[model samples]
Target: MIIKRTIRPLFSVIFVFAVAAVTLFFRAIVSGAGRDPYPDQNPFIISQTKHIPSLFNATLLKFSDVDLADASLRQNVEQLVDGDFLSFRTNRQRSFLSAGRYRLDIGVRNVRGSAMDLRSPEFHQLRLDFRRVLKDWWRQRRFDSEVLSKSNLVNALKGVKYKSCAVVGNSGILLKSNRGEEIDRHDFVIRLNNARIGGYERFVGSKTSLSFMNSNILHLCSRRGGCFCHPYGEKVPIMMYMSQPIHFLDYAVCNSSYKAPLMVTDPPLDMLCMRIVKYYSVKRFLKETGKELESWSGLHGGTEFHYSSGMQAIMLALGVCDKVSIYGFGKSDTAKHHYHTNQKTELSLHDYQAEYDLYEDLVNNPQAIPFISDKFKFPAVVIHR
Candidate 1:
């Protein structure tokens, strides 16, 4: 009897230890490695509880009643498109006014003035993480002597004050719009992805002030082994935004090889753009902001976490230009992917809808000095001629 009791107690003790081990393992899995257990200890821009699925569902319920075809334009959008336009131009203004706040809160305005310092201490703090990655890439450069003499990227556009700027996208809608003359009239013209402008110049304009592209494009171009120069014309400057650390190598090489003026995006500004997208993603997809500006946009929410190149170019224009005009932005029923080629634009990759919303917001914002449509011409209907 005594032996049986002793054995039972020992078995019970072992069972207790086994249960504790299992509990600890599950807890670790849930919390993630090196993460604090308490919610208070982990602070984020948006609450963690506002999960993507819930946010998307809420967005749908809020805008279920709105008609996609004939909805009124949002208070922010100045231009009116026909109901037949490919994407719904409904006034789905987000409650979060992040665009203006981004410039004001993140000190994007500080980059202006005579001395545009890229290596300032304040600038460094904002892009510290990106700077670290860049430093690593710089160390791996084959020829360190090829480095730029000037630290700032703004030197490329020195003594240039853009009074009116036109940011042109590759959307096929430009082909039919016949807005090339108006686009060429702008003081400065910005294009994305080194888009083709040879024959399309009549539609896209011939003037090329600045072009924005990511490093992946440069790397791919270099790998393709083509003499793919002069996409932006003979001597136009380029702003290459680094998407990864390895991109710095391609950038350095391009700087050495290419005769045209080339510049890189400052890391702080890059991060600031990222945060602005995050803010919009939350406001449009997750929050209870019940503002219905579109009929079918919520379904695609939580997919695009990054801003489009066109949007980034527009933001850059806002920093430098007195007035900004966007051309060839939205999709249309008859329009192809691009005006230059037969290629199709992937919608899932970038948040085009959100970017479109911002365009409308810029129109409504009175404080903004830049007029989106100072003498803008909308597409005209043709009866016979």
Candidate 2:
């Protein structure tokens, strides 16, 4: 045991060296791409129209080398998954329909079954009721009044140069390194269920950007005991979004895009739901006019498969930026025991690892510039050095 213990230090040193080498190599690759000359444009914006966008189709794959200038192709893909973008509902019926499209029913209501044949009539009736509720929502959507304004956000971002932002998950490791400040310093910072940022000023620091947490996280509150991880209750981000003033850009990427079993934000059913993210791509376009686009798949509507948890943030990322660096994303192998944040947004009844692996594969396999924060797991702050 002593021998192993003594050798363990040596092994850890070598491992760290390898990681450092990889980091350097990765940075070189990233910086080289940075220097490759801006492609005379920004991607992620679409041509605005009077009517809603229509869905084209969805593939299991994502494209890193997408050509952004092709508006028609981009628009098709977006229309397909647009249905999953920013749904929130209040009632059980509304929530079920909003979320059900993305959830594949596998068992008879045991786990989500791929086939609903075995579902009880009660379940079938529930599904029907939810479907009706969604249709009503769709009808109400036409009457929705969306308001978007450009503010001084860009100026607020003076001296900030992170073109690619990494949205971190709430794993406990952030507490170790005081990553909150580091995250805030990034050109852009998106935190998922940003629960424990309050009072841990040394750790969380001055977070300027927005968060993407749902009502459940708001209700349950993600602060547990001791480790800044848990199921404690407190005020949440939704209220902030409701009250905060304009920056050129400020938003909370909704993780539950497809599952908007919406509760009325104000009184009156006449008041439609308003989310800034629905127009994220447009904002990207407004920021940079000339960049070519990749796929605009997210602009439309589609079947249930489109809106899974954590998908919204990525989709929002896809709509606005060319190169993306995902942070706080949990690894497929260790999702259940994810050591980052307190609560994980569950996307399915199936094994989380399998689904997460699939999601990660869809991103990395496409050769996108993935600054995956999930790969390195350790104590406290891992300063970029």
Candidate 3:
């Protein structure tokens, strides 16, 4: 009886220790401790989330009954229905605005319109074909004839290199810098997200050669009457990267009305930008925190994290410009988030500090940039305070 009692107590103690060890193991797995998070799939490869739908498939065919009955909404519906003609007229107006400017030899063709009326059978059929082309692009990332006809960005940038380019960001630090003339001196000036330039011309230059934007900006414009999205005048060429698949429909509708070049970033270039930014962000996270890679997504809003528009602009400038100068890409604790707005906090989705680090690397050590192919010859980069 004494031996049995002694053995029972020892067995109970061992069982308690085993339970504690299992609990710790499970906690480690849940917290992504002591493990590589993305072992099965290569983190470098672009992976599509199954939860996010590829297309929104918004209806553009007919107006709702409620819209027709309301006179106030009737005009907007009519604008949607007559988008093609309005777009043609807008294009003509933009052409007029661009008159006598030093136009590029790039083929900026006039959009041809049929004599058939908007409600006519032929016109509707043409619209259907255009919509199909947009859907195909979203699904396959193929540049069809319609896309080529509407956009001259590729042709304008092809084989021609700029001597110097300035990429301007919207950070409020620009208010402190009286570098407008300096910014305008570059051969080409690229601005981001339709930032205001009216009263702030002394800080941000009056000249804009190109406007790079996210698809969200265009989507917002698509909601307005006639899709009036010309904040930097109607003649400046626009290059935008798609942020949402639904914005493809926005492009399809608004692109018809744009006079100057309106183009989406090619899939290859978009993927390259994504990979480079991700690499920098991940590297920063690992170095600064000494944390496992698995914990990064949880802290950074998972798949929602994205590079800022300024980063993409810099990448494009690197490819096409001989020298790139960046301005207004920094943040200060006291400064507002944007010079043109009252917003003070940075967006949670973007890691501005990580992007600044990237800019620093680009300026000081171009060879050290990771994930870019060795074939790419990075141009000289300078960042201005």
Candidate 4:
């Protein structure tokens, strides 16, 4: 009986030790390397995609219903159809706003008539084949309190008078171009990703009055559940409202301010305000009130990026800043990566001669400002490929 008691006690002790050991080992595993129970924490801007399917078929016709502003003239775009007008491809990316190294125009033209108005039957046949080229766009999602945040920079930017801004593209050239200090000297500086120099006050000076970012970028740089390049603590002032006001996972996240800064472009920043946001008027929106504007957009929300780099450069040159410089834009027909950030999609070869010709026509138009770039020399874009 005594031996049985001793055996029982020994077994009980062994069981207790085994339980404790397992708990400790599990805790150690949880605390060890490769233990990443955390969320995405990259310093790049990555808005979790809505409207777009997480996994899309490599081959599918994609079209954008979003507006392209000046890129798409109000007049329906109709011209010669040589069986190839435009096409879209999303093999490894959610969207390609512009074609990469290859010469491709990345946008949709609003044609008033149906897809069957081309002169030759080949045109109609081509349209059917290219249907997937015109059927993709980011959709609008409801503002989930748990998932979305409004523009905090906008609310904090009251009474700040920012006149000019320099949006520095972080091309490899920026490292050697010697434009760093000059870019920082401007009233504002917009840099993407961590880009090293953003926080180095010693290198680039103070924060460039306001920073402009897209949703994909903001999500990557957020700290709560995102990246932290500008770090979410110190409040940056709000500047002009950006284009493609996507709040609804449709609205943008800007600071509210009473004294609105100078809008960098025309048609007004308030025009970019979400239809869902209340106090949507430009006057009220810029008054620095911390109120959400009533959403005027339908369920689909505005998911298009209306301003291309060229368009934004033009907008800034014409409205925001007195002088403008271009860098890190337009590859040499060989530097084929479409985006500076982490976009895995490849651009399709779509003939945009019609669009390019259209742009050229505008340049020669009588109403265009002859010396538009002012004193800057815009190298003639060799588009004869």
Candidate with top TM-score is 3
Off by more than 4 A, model 1: 1-133, 136-156, 224-228, 287-304, 345-347, 366-385
Using lDDT as the yardstick, the better of models 1 and 3 is 3
The digit string of per-residue lDDT tens for model 4 on 207-323 reads 455444444343223212222335312444222323222110111111111133322222222222221111112122223443332221221123332333332332232233334
Residue 271's C-alpha lDDT in candidate 3? Answer: 53
Candidate 2 lDDT, 242-270, residue by residue in tens:
11010000111121221322121221111
Q: Which of the two candidates, 2 or 4, achieves a greater TM-score against the reference?
A: 4
**TM-score for every candidate vs. truth?**
0.53, 0.32, 0.64, 0.33
Error of 2 at 97 (Å): 17
Q: lDDT by residue for model 3 over 1-385, one digit each (tens)? A: 9999999999999999999999999998877753444455323322233532211101110110011112422332344344433432332222211222223212112223212254666445546644565455445543232221222333556446789999999999999979999999999999999999999999998999999999878755655556667799999988988765434545665677889878787655555555556556665676678777666667775556777899988887887788899999998877888999999888887888878878998988665554455556678899998
lDDT of 1: 0.52
For each candidate, the alpha-carbon lDDT, in order, equals: 0.52, 0.33, 0.66, 0.31
From the highest lDDT down, the ranking of the candidates is 3, 1, 2, 4
TM-score of 2: 0.32
Model 2 misplaced regions, further than 4 Å: 1-162, 173-178, 199-208, 215-309, 331-351, 367-385
lDDT of 4 at 34: 41
Query: Poorest 10 consecutive residues of model 4 by lDDT?
Result: 247-256
